[model samples]
Target: MAFVRVAALSQLPEGGALGVEAAGRRIAVARVDGEVYAFADNCSHRDFPLSHGEVDAAARTITCEWHGAAFCLLTGEPTCAPAFRPIAIYPAKVEDGAVWVEIADEPAPAEKAGGLRSLGI
Candidate 1:
């Protein structure tokens, strides 16, 4: 796996997530309090794009708009219902004014462990 440039820092909202493809996998890059984070773009519950979700910089979580599931940005752990599984978080960094994500040809086996379930909240 290697770090690949995805988007320009200036293009990402200060408290938002951006969907991008890295190593053919959908990834969400988020910015919070001048820092950057990356995780699987697809929500664990409904497989919706988490990039379209809302980011809570204060809580360090991203909420899925489809089902209102929230996941920790740093750990990718589910923070609420409608989603019990954690997302796959990838290594990310900001350098040269660009957002870089360390993506692999295939998500790590651990990252492939998420399950989908629509437990109505």
Candidate 2:
């Protein structure tokens, strides 16, 4: 795994999220209750950018502005209907006042033999 620095801890305000692109992937970095969370920036419902949506800090959910789908910030699970698919969640850690994400290596062909074979490893 490789850790990619996306932003500083102070860059994201509480109840707010920042859109970042790293290694050719769009990611949403959110800060809530003094903690930070990261997920794929696109909404599972309609492929909309979740970073443009509203963050409900109290509920720990992000509401997609395009279709009203709500997703849990902690787990990236859809809390509302019309979005049965979950967004890909990434592991985030803070070091030296900077936020870094753990990126998984590309899977081997045998390891992705199932439907995951389409993952393009």
Candidate 3:
């Protein structure tokens, strides 16, 4: 996977999360305590956009708004139910005042075998 520019670092406020499209993928980027994290934007429980959810800096998690599914900000592992499956996590960082995310050249992890499935998009 190669890192690609997604957004300006300034665009992500402290304790904030942003949804971006990069490398033909919908990624959710979050800023927690000055560190950046990225994951697939879709919720593992409802196929809803996780970007519409809330960011918990203290817990280092992002919660899905529809069914209260929460995922680890760094690992994309589901931390709460209605979402037992984990979403895909991407490496992210701030470089030269810009946010960069690495999208795997192969299919996203969430699409592979053992991947979680929500109701539908």
- lDDT (Cα atoms) of all candidates against the true structure: 0.87, 0.76, 0.85
Name the best candidate (by lDDT).
Answer: 1
After superposition on all C-alphas, the RMSD of every candidate to the true structure, in Å, is 2.1, 5.2, 1.9
Deviating ranges (above 4 Å) for candidate 1: 116-121
The total number of steric clashes, by the backbone 3 Å criterion, in model 3 comes to: 0
**Which is superior by lDDT, 1 or 3?**
1
Counted clashes in each candidate structure: 0, 0, 0
What would the per-residue lDDT of candidate 3 be over residues 1-121, giving only the tens digit for each residue? 7999999999988888889998777788999988999988888887788888899988999999898989998777889888888899888889999999988888677756334467453
Tell me, by TM-score, which candidate is best.
3
**Which residue pairs come into collision in candidate 3?**
none
lDDT by residue for model 2 (9-39), tens: 8888888988998777778888888777888
* Model 3 deviation from native, Cα RMSD in Å: 1.9
Q: What TM-score do all the candidates reach, one by one?
A: 0.91, 0.82, 0.92
**Model 2 stretches with alpha carbons more than 4 Å out:** 107-121
Better of 2 and 3 by lDDT: 3
